[model samples]
Target: MRELIKEAIVDLKRNDGFIYVTAEGKKIDLHEAAARGIAVTPVNPKDQVIKKLESAGLHLTDNKFVADLNELISVLNGGGSSKSAGKRRSFSDDEKSKILEEWQKVEAAGKKTKAAFAREIGVGYQTFINWLRG
Candidate 1:
């Protein structure tokens, strides 16, 4: 693939799963490089080309980016690096019982179901289900 990119895309080399080209002493992605009329395979499908360019930019597909960024900020703020940015919230015993009671009433009445209860309580349905299991 590297050889193919080098041969087909002028001045661009495959680096860390991204084809990069040096322009004005800074590295740029193959797409931008191609936009500058540098060679990348034009005949190939776009999705295939994008897959080849995977994990190279600010595009984080996983949901952990905000947590990771928050942790970084916490570190920068002189807090312990081992700390979490409120990943979980605990309900008081009273609150838990209230929620469970309301949930049971809804279930018994065949009314607003699990999802509706979760929404009312501002929690995900899976979390509400877990609460029921406990």
Candidate 2:
């Protein structure tokens, strides 16, 4: 893993427009790195909050962090029933390609059915069809 990280850093350096090391220290342009697929990630507020808490000698597992947040909500609501949170899912380009490949395999079989393909890929039938259209 260390060697892979080192290789990635070297590759990033080769793409001179994105990364730079100044007289003071190293600097990285996140936008440029993301555009080049070198370091693509969503901005996670939970991670930022965890970092702040860690400095104060507080450590939290992901589940514990979520439970604490839920408890805070319960307190704010004066012990009212808390609503369950629902998260929207997203897929990366690689994952989309893999799904498409799976769909193609299903199509190559004797029976070609979108619903079956969607079910196998853990997506709604309509959504799978839309992906194929795209």
Candidate 3:
């Protein structure tokens, strides 16, 4: 297959369009590259395959709106990142000692681990461990 593709690239002899060099060292025709798999849509207007692949899910996503303001108000409270959902802001040492003192009681209860207590208190796992070590 590697030898076959190398031979095909040598035979094709044009570098003007989207040339997909695969993991197997196979160089595919743009149409063949799209047909095989993956979502890399390359566009050079002078390249003949541009118009066809442009229709194949790449350029369309560029114009996509993820959500409207109405959706934000209806569901999320102004829609901050979902990735930061459980995480909270940082706090100072006096505030931390206060949190950790309370956190120790929660640990005494033995239901929450130090890591979970850290999440509730808004410090990182290492920072919480460092606080405990101190």
Candidate 4:
């Protein structure tokens, strides 16, 4: 597991990352990072909060440290989306492709069938079909 982490850190393709530096000043290792639930996340580092921290000479140790501060801010603002919060649900890549394919087939038919689309989702099949038309 430790070896895998070192490989990941060595093979890191971006400057962005979550790193783990041993308290003993040893080389930052990836296994410790994985244990800490690390990943390469994208966000503006020099945003307002980052700027404030940097300006105050409060140096951050790693991405987790920065994310922890972001989470605190989201909680203060009525529990909004934080660094740890999962993003909203939406169609997956496959689902998006399926939707486009279905749409094309329907358009080519020239006569759309008001059938049960959301049958698997909605409570009653008929009700869901009615919704699709509207």
Best by TM-score: 2
Clashing pairs counted in every model: 1, 0, 0, 0
Better of 1 and 4 by TM-score: 1
Give the candidates in order of TM-score, highest first: 2, 1, 3, 4
lDDT of 1 by residue, 7-123 (tens): 435433334444443534344666677788764432233333444445343223444775776777888898965654455657887898899998888899998978987988888
Say which prediction, candidate 2 or candidate 4, comes out ahead on TM-score. Answer: 2
* Strongest candidate by lDDT: 1
lDDT of 2 by residue, 1-134 (tens): 45544544454445333333233433445666556556333323344445545565445556776687777779788884344345345788899998898778778884768887678667788888888998
What is the C-alpha local distance difference test score of each model? 0.63, 0.61, 0.60, 0.49
Over 4 Å off, model 4:
1-89, 113-134
Name the Cα RMSD for model 3: 15.7
CA displacement after TM-score superposition, residue 51 of candidate 4 (Å): 44
Per-residue lDDT of 27-86 in model 4, one digit per residue for the tens?
344665567755433333234234445556544546776677777777888887644456
Model 1 ranges off by over 4 Å = 1-88
How well does model 1 score by local distance difference test?
0.63
lDDT of 3 by residue, 75-106 (tens): 56765655446866567889878987898788
Instruction: Supply the TM-score for candidate 2.
Output: 0.37
Candidate no. 3 TM-score: 0.33
lDDT of 2: 0.61
